[model samples]
Target: MFEVEVKYRVPNHDAIRDRLKALNAKFLEHTEETDIYLNSPLRDFAKTDEALRVRVYGDGTVVLTYKGPRIGNVGKTREELSVTANDLDSLLEILRRLDFREVAKVVKRRDIYNYENFTIYLDTVEDLGSFVEVETMVNDKELINRATDEVLQFGDKLGLKREWIEKRTYLELVLERGNERR
Candidate 1:
Protein backbone atom coordinates (compact mmCIF):
# COMPACT_ATOMS: atom_id res chain seq x y z
CA MET A 1 0.00 0.00 0.00
CA PHE A 2 1.02 3.61 -0.48
CA GLU A 3 1.04 6.15 2.28
CA VAL A 4 -0.15 9.47 0.87
CA GLU A 5 0.82 12.45 2.96
CA VAL A 6 1.02 16.22 3.14
CA LYS A 7 3.20 17.95 5.71
CA TYR A 8 3.45 21.61 6.65
CA ARG A 9 5.59 23.64 8.99
CA VAL A 10 3.12 25.37 11.26
CA PRO A 11 4.12 27.95 13.86
CA ASN A 12 1.19 27.32 16.18
CA HIS A 13 0.33 23.76 17.08
CA ASP A 14 -2.37 24.76 19.59
CA ALA A 15 -4.26 26.42 16.76
CA ILE A 16 -4.14 23.23 14.75
CA ARG A 17 -5.24 21.20 17.77
CA ASP A 18 -8.18 23.52 18.30
CA ARG A 19 -9.07 23.21 14.65
CA LEU A 20 -9.05 19.44 14.93
CA LYS A 21 -11.22 19.61 18.01
CA ALA A 22 -13.71 21.89 16.26
CA LEU A 23 -13.80 19.51 13.32
CA ASN A 24 -14.67 16.68 15.72
CA ALA A 25 -11.64 14.65 14.80
CA LYS A 26 -11.20 11.54 16.91
CA PHE A 27 -8.27 11.98 19.22
CA LEU A 28 -5.78 9.15 19.03
CA GLU A 29 -2.82 8.47 21.24
CA HIS A 30 -0.15 11.07 21.99
CA THR A 31 3.24 9.47 22.14
CA GLU A 32 6.91 10.18 21.77
CA GLU A 33 8.70 8.50 18.89
CA THR A 34 12.34 7.78 18.38
CA ASP A 35 13.16 6.96 14.79
CA ILE A 36 16.48 5.39 13.92
CA TYR A 37 17.28 5.63 10.24
CA LEU A 38 19.54 3.15 8.52
CA ASN A 39 21.44 3.11 5.25
CA SER A 40 21.99 0.10 3.06
CA PRO A 41 25.56 -0.90 2.35
CA LEU A 42 24.68 -1.82 -1.24
CA ARG A 43 23.33 1.58 -2.31
CA ASP A 44 22.75 5.14 -1.26
CA PHE A 45 19.13 5.38 -0.09
CA ALA A 46 19.41 9.17 -0.19
CA LYS A 47 20.07 9.06 -3.92
CA THR A 48 17.41 6.43 -4.46
CA ASP A 49 14.81 8.37 -2.44
CA GLU A 50 14.10 5.36 -0.23
CA ALA A 51 14.14 5.14 3.54
CA LEU A 52 14.57 2.40 6.16
CA ARG A 53 13.93 3.12 9.79
CA VAL A 54 13.12 1.55 13.12
CA ARG A 55 10.59 3.52 15.09
CA VAL A 56 10.33 3.05 18.85
CA TYR A 57 7.19 4.46 20.43
CA GLY A 58 6.80 5.79 23.96
CA ASP A 59 5.27 2.57 25.25
CA GLY A 60 8.27 0.57 23.95
CA THR A 61 6.70 -0.93 20.84
CA VAL A 62 9.08 -1.13 17.90
CA VAL A 63 8.07 -0.79 14.27
CA LEU A 64 10.41 -1.20 11.34
CA THR A 65 9.42 0.70 8.19
CA TYR A 66 10.53 1.00 4.61
CA LYS A 67 9.41 4.01 2.56
CA GLY A 68 9.79 4.08 -1.20
CA PRO A 69 10.30 7.14 -3.39
CA ARG A 70 7.67 9.83 -3.60
CA ILE A 71 5.02 9.05 -6.24
CA GLY A 72 3.91 12.52 -7.45
CA ASN A 73 4.27 16.27 -7.14
CA VAL A 74 1.12 16.83 -5.10
CA GLY A 75 2.38 15.36 -1.85
CA LYS A 76 4.67 12.82 -0.20
CA THR A 77 2.95 9.78 -1.56
CA ARG A 78 5.08 6.66 -1.22
CA GLU A 79 4.93 2.89 -0.86
CA GLU A 80 5.38 2.23 2.83
CA LEU A 81 5.84 -1.21 4.36
CA SER A 82 6.07 -1.72 8.05
CA VAL A 83 6.16 -4.50 10.59
CA THR A 84 6.03 -4.69 14.35
CA ALA A 85 9.14 -6.11 15.92
CA ASN A 86 9.02 -7.89 19.22
CA ASP A 87 12.67 -7.34 20.11
CA LEU A 88 14.13 -3.94 19.43
CA ASP A 89 17.77 -4.79 20.13
CA SER A 90 17.53 -8.00 18.13
CA LEU A 91 16.00 -6.14 15.25
CA LEU A 92 18.87 -3.64 15.22
CA GLU A 93 21.36 -6.47 15.54
CA ILE A 94 19.76 -8.30 12.66
CA LEU A 95 19.96 -5.18 10.50
CA ARG A 96 23.57 -4.71 11.51
CA ARG A 97 24.36 -8.30 10.71
CA LEU A 98 22.85 -7.79 7.32
CA ASP A 99 25.10 -4.73 6.80
CA PHE A 100 22.59 -1.92 7.34
CA ARG A 101 24.26 0.99 9.14
CA GLU A 102 22.52 3.47 11.35
CA VAL A 103 22.75 7.04 10.05
CA ALA A 104 20.45 9.33 12.02
CA LYS A 105 17.92 9.54 14.82
CA VAL A 106 14.86 11.78 15.04
CA VAL A 107 12.99 12.18 18.31
CA LYS A 108 9.55 13.73 18.36
CA ARG A 109 6.35 14.07 20.35
CA ARG A 110 3.26 13.30 18.29
CA ASP A 111 -0.44 13.82 18.83
CA ILE A 112 -2.48 11.71 16.43
CA TYR A 113 -6.00 12.45 15.29
CA ASN A 114 -8.35 10.62 12.98
CA TYR A 115 -10.71 12.63 10.78
CA GLU A 116 -12.78 10.72 8.28
CA ASN A 117 -10.35 8.66 6.21
CA PHE A 118 -7.32 10.70 7.12
CA THR A 119 -4.87 10.35 9.99
CA ILE A 120 -3.33 13.60 11.17
CA TYR A 121 -0.20 14.11 13.19
CA LEU A 122 0.78 17.14 15.21
CA ASP A 123 4.52 16.67 15.60
CA THR A 124 7.18 18.53 17.53
CA VAL A 125 10.65 17.28 16.72
CA GLU A 126 13.43 17.75 19.18
CA ASP A 127 15.39 20.19 17.01
CA LEU A 128 13.01 20.94 14.15
CA GLY A 129 10.06 22.64 15.88
CA SER A 130 6.36 22.17 15.08
CA PHE A 131 4.59 20.66 12.08
CA VAL A 132 1.36 18.98 11.03
CA GLU A 133 1.06 16.01 8.71
CA VAL A 134 -2.06 14.63 7.06
CA GLU A 135 -2.00 11.14 5.64
CA THR A 136 -4.06 8.28 4.26
CA MET A 137 -3.16 4.81 3.04
CA VAL A 138 -4.18 3.53 -0.37
CA ASN A 139 -3.66 0.08 -1.85
CA ASP A 140 -4.16 0.65 -5.57
CA LYS A 141 -1.59 2.47 -7.70
CA GLU A 142 -4.38 4.23 -9.59
CA LEU A 143 -5.63 5.82 -6.37
CA ILE A 144 -2.29 7.46 -5.50
CA ASN A 145 -3.03 10.78 -7.16
CA ARG A 146 -6.48 11.02 -5.66
CA ALA A 147 -5.14 10.12 -2.22
CA THR A 148 -2.50 12.80 -2.47
CA ASP A 149 -5.07 15.41 -3.41
CA GLU A 150 -7.31 14.41 -0.54
CA VAL A 151 -4.43 14.59 1.91
CA LEU A 152 -3.57 18.11 0.74
CA GLN A 153 -7.19 19.22 0.85
CA PHE A 154 -7.55 17.95 4.41
CA GLY A 155 -4.47 19.98 5.36
CA ASP A 156 -6.16 23.01 3.79
CA LYS A 157 -9.21 22.45 5.97
CA LEU A 158 -6.89 22.64 8.97
CA GLY A 159 -5.77 26.10 7.74
CA LEU A 160 -2.34 25.12 6.43
CA LYS A 161 -1.07 27.36 3.65
CA ARG A 162 0.25 25.85 0.44
CA GLU A 163 3.49 27.78 0.86
CA TRP A 164 4.00 26.22 4.28
CA ILE A 165 4.27 22.74 2.78
CA GLU A 166 7.60 21.10 3.49
CA LYS A 167 8.83 18.46 1.09
CA ARG A 168 11.98 17.44 2.92
CA THR A 169 11.89 14.47 5.24
CA TYR A 170 12.78 14.85 8.91
CA LEU A 171 15.96 12.83 8.33
CA GLU A 172 17.06 15.25 5.63
CA LEU A 173 16.18 18.25 7.76
CA VAL A 174 18.09 16.88 10.75
CA LEU A 175 21.12 16.03 8.66
CA GLU A 176 21.10 19.47 7.06
CA ARG A 177 20.97 21.08 10.47
CA GLY A 178 23.91 18.96 11.62
CA ASN A 179 25.86 20.04 8.56
CA GLU A 180 25.16 23.69 9.24
CA ARG A 181 26.63 23.35 12.73
CA ARG A 182 29.79 21.63 11.46
Candidate 2:
Protein backbone atom coordinates (compact mmCIF):
# COMPACT_ATOMS: atom_id res chain seq x y z
CA MET A 1 0.00 0.00 0.00
CA PHE A 2 0.94 3.62 -0.39
CA GLU A 3 0.77 6.37 2.19
CA VAL A 4 -0.13 9.68 0.60
CA GLU A 5 0.32 12.54 2.99
CA VAL A 6 0.59 16.28 3.32
CA LYS A 7 2.15 18.01 6.29
CA TYR A 8 2.25 21.54 7.64
CA ARG A 9 4.21 23.44 10.21
CA VAL A 10 1.59 25.28 12.16
CA PRO A 11 1.84 27.98 14.79
CA ASN A 12 -1.23 27.04 16.78
CA HIS A 13 -2.14 23.41 17.45
CA ASP A 14 -5.07 24.15 19.75
CA ALA A 15 -6.73 26.11 16.96
CA ILE A 16 -6.40 23.15 14.63
CA ARG A 17 -7.84 20.80 17.24
CA ASP A 18 -10.76 23.21 17.68
CA ARG A 19 -11.28 23.23 13.95
CA LEU A 20 -11.29 19.43 13.85
CA LYS A 21 -13.81 19.37 16.67
CA ALA A 22 -15.97 21.88 14.85
CA LEU A 23 -15.89 19.68 11.78
CA ASN A 24 -17.14 16.79 13.87
CA ALA A 25 -14.09 14.74 13.18
CA LYS A 26 -13.82 11.53 15.15
CA PHE A 27 -11.24 11.67 17.88
CA LEU A 28 -9.03 8.63 17.59
CA GLU A 29 -6.30 8.63 20.20
CA HIS A 30 -3.82 10.86 21.94
CA THR A 31 -0.54 9.09 22.44
CA GLU A 32 3.17 9.53 22.68
CA GLU A 33 5.42 7.91 20.05
CA THR A 34 9.10 7.32 19.86
CA ASP A 35 10.64 6.47 16.48
CA ILE A 36 14.13 5.10 16.26
CA TYR A 37 15.49 5.48 12.72
CA LEU A 38 18.20 3.14 11.52
CA ASN A 39 20.66 3.43 8.69
CA SER A 40 21.18 0.61 6.23
CA PRO A 41 24.56 -1.04 5.96
CA LEU A 42 24.56 -1.15 2.17
CA ARG A 43 23.54 2.39 1.26
CA ASP A 44 22.97 5.84 2.61
CA PHE A 45 19.28 6.37 3.43
CA ALA A 46 19.82 10.11 3.70
CA LYS A 47 20.92 10.27 0.07
CA THR A 48 18.39 7.71 -1.12
CA ASP A 49 15.47 9.52 0.55
CA GLU A 50 14.28 6.36 2.22
CA ALA A 51 13.67 5.51 5.87
CA LEU A 52 13.45 2.46 8.08
CA ARG A 53 12.28 2.87 11.62
CA VAL A 54 10.72 1.11 14.53
CA ARG A 55 8.00 3.09 16.21
CA VAL A 56 7.02 2.30 19.78
CA TYR A 57 3.55 3.58 20.56
CA GLY A 58 2.44 4.70 24.00
CA ASP A 59 0.19 1.69 24.46
CA GLY A 60 3.20 -0.66 24.11
CA THR A 61 2.53 -1.65 20.51
CA VAL A 62 5.53 -1.60 18.23
CA VAL A 63 5.58 -1.17 14.47
CA LEU A 64 8.30 -1.58 11.88
CA THR A 65 7.95 0.73 8.91
CA TYR A 66 9.75 1.17 5.64
CA LYS A 67 9.16 4.36 3.68
CA GLY A 68 10.30 4.42 0.08
CA PRO A 69 11.31 7.50 -1.86
CA ARG A 70 8.56 10.05 -2.17
CA ILE A 71 6.70 10.65 -5.39
CA GLY A 72 5.15 13.74 -7.06
CA ASN A 73 5.52 17.38 -6.06
CA VAL A 74 2.28 18.39 -4.37
CA GLY A 75 2.47 16.12 -1.36
CA LYS A 76 4.63 13.45 0.17
CA THR A 77 3.48 10.35 -1.63
CA ARG A 78 5.38 7.15 -0.98
CA GLU A 79 5.24 3.40 -0.88
CA GLU A 80 4.92 2.51 2.77
CA LEU A 81 4.98 -0.93 4.27
CA SER A 82 4.49 -1.57 7.95
CA VAL A 83 3.97 -4.51 10.21
CA THR A 84 3.35 -4.97 13.89
CA ALA A 85 6.10 -6.73 15.79
CA ASN A 86 5.66 -9.08 18.72
CA ASP A 87 9.00 -8.22 20.27
CA LEU A 88 10.50 -4.76 19.94
CA ASP A 89 13.78 -5.64 21.58
CA SER A 90 14.31 -8.69 19.44
CA LEU A 91 13.58 -6.77 16.29
CA LEU A 92 15.96 -4.02 17.29
CA GLU A 93 18.62 -6.55 18.12
CA ILE A 94 18.14 -8.24 14.76
CA LEU A 95 18.53 -4.97 12.91
CA ARG A 96 21.57 -4.08 14.98
CA ARG A 97 23.20 -7.42 14.31
CA LEU A 98 22.56 -6.94 10.61
CA ASP A 99 24.68 -3.75 10.84
CA PHE A 100 21.88 -1.20 10.87
CA ARG A 101 23.07 1.79 12.84
CA GLU A 102 20.84 4.07 14.81
CA VAL A 103 20.60 7.49 13.26
CA ALA A 104 18.12 9.58 15.24
CA LYS A 105 15.35 9.19 17.75
CA VAL A 106 12.16 11.23 17.30
CA VAL A 107 9.79 11.67 20.21
CA LYS A 108 6.37 13.23 19.81
CA ARG A 109 3.00 13.55 21.46
CA ARG A 110 0.26 13.18 18.89
CA ASP A 111 -3.48 13.72 18.72
CA ILE A 112 -5.05 11.66 15.96
CA TYR A 113 -8.42 12.34 14.35
CA ASN A 114 -10.35 10.96 11.46
CA TYR A 115 -12.52 12.94 9.06
CA GLU A 116 -14.04 11.35 6.01
CA ASN A 117 -11.15 9.81 4.06
CA PHE A 118 -8.31 11.43 5.92
CA THR A 119 -6.49 10.66 9.11
CA ILE A 120 -5.02 13.76 10.70
CA TYR A 121 -2.22 14.08 13.20
CA LEU A 122 -1.40 17.01 15.42
CA ASP A 123 2.11 16.44 16.69
CA THR A 124 4.57 18.22 18.92
CA VAL A 125 8.05 16.76 18.59
CA GLU A 126 10.83 17.00 21.10
CA ASP A 127 13.12 19.33 19.18
CA LEU A 128 10.84 20.35 16.35
CA GLY A 129 7.80 22.53 16.77
CA SER A 130 4.16 21.77 16.06
CA PHE A 131 3.11 19.93 12.90
CA VAL A 132 -0.11 18.75 11.32
CA GLU A 133 -0.32 15.82 8.92
CA VAL A 134 -3.20 14.58 6.80
CA GLU A 135 -2.80 11.17 5.26
CA THR A 136 -4.64 8.31 3.62
CA MET A 137 -3.81 4.78 2.56
CA VAL A 138 -4.42 3.54 -0.97
CA ASN A 139 -3.93 0.07 -2.32
CA ASP A 140 -3.66 1.00 -5.98
CA LYS A 141 -0.85 3.11 -7.35
CA GLU A 142 -3.19 4.77 -9.86
CA LEU A 143 -5.18 6.35 -7.04
CA ILE A 144 -2.26 8.38 -5.65
CA ASN A 145 -2.93 11.47 -7.76
CA ARG A 146 -6.56 11.62 -6.76
CA ALA A 147 -5.66 10.93 -3.14
CA THR A 148 -3.06 13.68 -3.14
CA ASP A 149 -5.55 16.19 -4.47
CA GLU A 150 -8.07 15.25 -1.86
CA VAL A 151 -5.47 15.51 0.92
CA LEU A 152 -4.49 19.00 -0.23
CA GLN A 153 -8.09 20.11 -0.36
CA PHE A 154 -8.75 18.66 3.04
CA GLY A 155 -5.74 20.50 4.41
CA ASP A 156 -7.03 23.70 2.84
CA LYS A 157 -10.41 23.26 4.50
CA LEU A 158 -8.57 23.01 7.81
CA GLY A 159 -7.01 26.48 7.22
CA LEU A 160 -3.59 25.21 6.24
CA LYS A 161 -2.01 27.63 3.82
CA ARG A 162 0.42 26.72 1.07
CA GLU A 163 3.27 28.52 2.74
CA TRP A 164 2.78 26.50 5.88
CA ILE A 165 3.35 23.21 4.10
CA GLU A 166 6.44 21.32 5.23
CA LYS A 167 8.32 18.51 3.50
CA ARG A 168 10.85 17.50 6.14
CA THR A 169 10.16 14.68 8.54
CA TYR A 170 10.60 15.16 12.29
CA LEU A 171 13.78 13.09 12.25
CA GLU A 172 15.26 15.20 9.44
CA LEU A 173 14.46 18.41 11.25
CA VAL A 174 15.97 17.15 14.50
CA LEU A 175 19.16 16.01 12.79
CA GLU A 176 19.48 19.28 10.90
CA ARG A 177 19.10 21.25 14.11
CA GLY A 178 21.86 19.21 15.70
CA ASN A 179 24.13 19.91 12.77
CA GLU A 180 23.53 23.66 13.03
CA ARG A 181 24.53 23.61 16.68
CA ARG A 182 28.04 22.47 15.72
Candidate 3:
Protein backbone atom coordinates (compact mmCIF):
# COMPACT_ATOMS: atom_id res chain seq x y z
CA MET A 1 0.00 0.00 0.00
CA PHE A 2 2.23 2.79 -1.22
CA GLU A 3 0.72 6.17 -0.31
CA VAL A 4 1.15 8.87 -2.94
CA GLU A 5 -0.12 12.24 -1.86
CA VAL A 6 -0.04 16.01 -2.35
CA LYS A 7 -1.27 19.09 -0.47
CA TYR A 8 -1.95 22.74 -1.11
CA ARG A 9 -2.91 25.89 0.71
CA VAL A 10 -6.71 26.21 0.83
CA PRO A 11 -8.32 29.61 0.73
CA ASN A 12 -11.21 28.52 2.88
CA HIS A 13 -12.84 25.34 4.13
CA ASP A 14 -16.35 26.27 3.11
CA ALA A 15 -15.33 26.68 -0.52
CA ILE A 16 -13.68 23.27 -0.59
CA ARG A 17 -16.52 21.68 1.35
CA ASP A 18 -19.02 22.92 -1.23
CA ARG A 19 -17.02 21.36 -4.02
CA LEU A 20 -16.72 18.14 -2.10
CA LYS A 21 -20.47 18.07 -1.50
CA ALA A 22 -21.06 18.64 -5.17
CA LEU A 23 -18.99 15.54 -5.75
CA ASN A 24 -21.28 13.73 -3.27
CA ALA A 25 -18.72 13.67 -0.52
CA LYS A 26 -19.40 14.20 3.16
CA PHE A 27 -17.43 15.94 5.89
CA LEU A 28 -16.32 13.53 8.54
CA GLU A 29 -15.91 14.82 12.07
CA HIS A 30 -12.81 16.83 12.82
CA THR A 31 -10.11 14.69 14.38
CA GLU A 32 -7.64 15.95 16.93
CA GLU A 33 -4.50 13.89 16.44
CA THR A 34 -1.99 13.89 19.27
CA ASP A 35 1.52 12.76 18.50
CA ILE A 36 4.17 11.91 21.11
CA TYR A 37 7.69 11.81 19.69
CA LEU A 38 10.28 9.74 21.44
CA ASN A 39 14.01 9.15 21.32
CA SER A 40 15.27 5.78 20.17
CA PRO A 41 18.79 4.46 20.40
CA LEU A 42 18.95 2.18 17.38
CA ARG A 43 17.37 1.19 14.09
CA ASP A 44 15.79 3.82 11.80
CA PHE A 45 14.37 5.85 14.69
CA ALA A 46 17.83 6.63 15.98
CA LYS A 47 19.28 7.67 12.64
CA THR A 48 16.62 10.33 12.03
CA ASP A 49 15.45 13.44 13.85
CA GLU A 50 11.69 13.12 14.17
CA ALA A 51 9.00 12.71 16.75
CA LEU A 52 7.03 9.59 17.74
CA ARG A 53 3.33 10.27 18.16
CA VAL A 54 0.24 8.48 19.38
CA ARG A 55 -2.54 9.90 17.21
CA VAL A 56 -6.20 9.88 18.19
CA TYR A 57 -8.32 10.61 15.16
CA GLY A 58 -11.87 11.48 16.20
CA ASP A 59 -13.71 9.04 18.44
CA GLY A 60 -11.57 5.94 18.62
CA THR A 61 -9.39 6.21 15.56
CA VAL A 62 -6.22 5.71 17.54
CA VAL A 63 -2.81 5.21 16.03
CA LEU A 64 0.88 5.50 16.86
CA THR A 65 2.88 7.18 14.11
CA TYR A 66 6.25 8.86 14.09
CA LYS A 67 6.05 12.63 14.35
CA GLY A 68 8.48 12.75 11.46
CA PRO A 69 8.75 9.32 9.92
CA ARG A 70 11.19 9.52 7.06
CA ILE A 71 9.35 10.89 4.03
CA GLY A 72 8.25 8.14 1.62
CA ASN A 73 9.64 5.46 3.92
CA VAL A 74 6.13 4.17 4.66
CA GLY A 75 4.58 5.78 1.63
CA LYS A 76 3.45 2.71 -0.27
CA THR A 77 1.93 0.80 2.57
CA ARG A 78 -1.46 0.39 4.30
CA GLU A 79 0.18 2.40 7.02
CA GLU A 80 -2.86 3.77 8.86
CA LEU A 81 -4.45 2.09 11.89
CA SER A 82 -7.87 3.22 13.16
CA VAL A 83 -9.82 2.02 16.15
CA THR A 84 -13.44 0.95 16.37
CA ALA A 85 -15.84 3.72 17.37
CA ASN A 86 -19.15 3.10 19.05
CA ASP A 87 -19.30 6.64 20.36
CA LEU A 88 -16.81 9.49 20.75
CA ASP A 89 -17.43 10.09 24.42
CA SER A 90 -15.83 6.87 25.62
CA LEU A 91 -12.76 7.61 23.64
CA LEU A 92 -12.59 11.22 24.79
CA GLU A 93 -13.01 10.14 28.37
CA ILE A 94 -10.09 7.82 28.02
CA LEU A 95 -7.91 10.54 26.55
CA ARG A 96 -8.71 13.00 29.34
CA ARG A 97 -7.17 10.71 31.94
CA LEU A 98 -3.95 10.00 30.13
CA ASP A 99 -1.17 12.55 30.49
CA PHE A 100 -0.17 13.00 26.89
CA ARG A 101 3.26 14.41 26.24
CA GLU A 102 3.16 17.75 24.44
CA VAL A 103 4.95 18.57 21.27
CA ALA A 104 5.61 21.88 19.50
CA LYS A 105 1.99 22.25 18.44
CA VAL A 106 -1.42 20.59 18.24
CA VAL A 107 -3.25 20.57 14.93
CA LYS A 108 -6.97 20.52 14.27
CA ARG A 109 -7.66 18.84 10.97
CA ARG A 110 -10.93 18.19 9.16
CA ASP A 111 -11.14 14.98 7.16
CA ILE A 112 -13.25 14.78 4.01
CA TYR A 113 -13.26 11.45 2.26
CA ASN A 114 -14.31 11.14 -1.34
CA TYR A 115 -16.38 8.08 -2.02
CA GLU A 116 -14.32 8.11 -5.21
CA ASN A 117 -11.23 6.63 -3.48
CA PHE A 118 -9.47 9.74 -2.26
CA THR A 119 -9.33 11.54 1.09
CA ILE A 120 -8.94 15.27 1.54
CA TYR A 121 -7.97 16.69 4.88
CA LEU A 122 -8.13 20.36 5.85
CA ASP A 123 -5.74 21.27 8.58
CA THR A 124 -5.79 24.33 10.92
CA VAL A 125 -2.76 24.43 13.11
CA GLU A 126 -2.20 26.49 16.21
CA ASP A 127 -0.02 28.81 14.18
CA LEU A 128 -0.35 27.71 10.60
CA GLY A 129 -3.19 29.32 8.68
CA SER A 130 -4.87 26.58 6.61
CA PHE A 131 -3.78 23.70 4.40
CA VAL A 132 -5.30 20.79 2.51
CA GLU A 133 -4.16 17.25 1.81
CA VAL A 134 -5.10 14.75 -0.89
CA GLU A 135 -3.99 11.17 -0.34
CA THR A 136 -4.43 7.96 -2.34
CA MET A 137 -2.76 4.58 -2.25
CA VAL A 138 -1.16 3.07 -5.32
CA ASN A 139 0.97 0.12 -6.33
CA ASP A 140 3.75 0.03 -8.95
CA LYS A 141 5.62 3.03 -10.24
CA GLU A 142 3.35 3.65 -13.20
CA LEU A 143 0.25 3.74 -11.03
CA ILE A 144 1.97 5.89 -8.46
CA ASN A 145 2.95 8.33 -11.15
CA ARG A 146 -0.56 8.24 -12.48
CA ALA A 147 -1.97 8.84 -9.01
CA THR A 148 0.40 11.73 -8.54
CA ASP A 149 -0.76 13.12 -11.84
CA GLU A 150 -4.39 12.66 -10.90
CA VAL A 151 -3.83 14.48 -7.64
CA LEU A 152 -2.04 17.20 -9.50
CA GLN A 153 -4.92 17.50 -11.92
CA PHE A 154 -7.34 17.94 -9.04
CA GLY A 155 -5.00 20.38 -7.39
CA ASP A 156 -5.09 22.37 -10.58
CA LYS A 157 -8.86 22.08 -10.72
CA LEU A 158 -8.97 23.48 -7.22
CA GLY A 159 -6.36 26.07 -8.11
CA LEU A 160 -3.87 24.65 -5.63
CA LYS A 161 -0.22 23.78 -5.91
CA ARG A 162 -0.52 24.15 -9.66
CA GLU A 163 3.23 23.98 -10.05
CA TRP A 164 4.52 22.94 -6.64
CA ILE A 165 4.11 19.20 -6.14
CA GLU A 166 4.30 18.78 -2.38
CA LYS A 167 4.64 15.33 -0.76
CA ARG A 168 5.44 16.10 2.85
CA THR A 169 3.19 14.62 5.51
CA TYR A 170 0.50 16.98 6.85
CA LEU A 171 2.26 17.03 10.21
CA GLU A 172 5.60 18.21 8.94
CA LEU A 173 4.24 21.08 6.87
CA VAL A 174 1.78 22.19 9.50
CA LEU A 175 4.46 22.15 12.16
CA GLU A 176 6.90 24.10 10.05
CA ARG A 177 4.28 26.59 8.99
CA GLY A 178 2.94 26.85 12.49
CA ASN A 179 6.40 27.56 13.87
CA GLU A 180 6.91 30.20 11.22
CA ARG A 181 3.58 31.79 12.06
CA ARG A 182 4.84 32.44 15.53
For candidate 1, the TM-score is 0.97
lDDT of 1 by residue, 11-50 (tens): 9698898999999999989999999999999999999999
Residue 123 lDDT in candidate 1: 97
Error of 2 at 67 (Å): 0.8
Those runs of model 3 whose alpha carbons end farther than 4 Å from true positions after fitting are: 43-51, 66-105, 163-182
Best by TM-score: 1
Candidate 1 C-alpha RMSD relative to the actual structure: 0.8
CA lDDT of every candidate: 0.93, 0.93, 0.56
TM-score of model 3 vs. true structure = 0.64
By TM-score, the candidates rank as 1, 2, 3
Lowest-scoring 10 consecutive residues by lDDT in candidate 3?
A: 73-82
Residue pair clashes in candidate 1: none
* lDDT tens per residue, model 3, 49-140: 45555555655565555433333432322233334445445544454456333343355656656646677777664555577777787656
Task: Arrange candidates, best lDDT first.
Answer: 1, 2, 3
Q: Alpha-carbon error at 110 in model 3, in Å?
A: 1.3
Candidate scoring better on lDDT of 1 and 3: 1
Question: On residues 1-182, what C-alpha lDDT tens digit does candidate 2 reach at each position?
Answer: 98999999999698888889999999999999999999999999999999999999998999999999988887789898899998999999999999999999999999999999899999998878899999998999999999999999999889999799998877789899989999
Instruction: Locate the minimum summed-lDDT window of 10 residues in model 1.
Output: 145-154
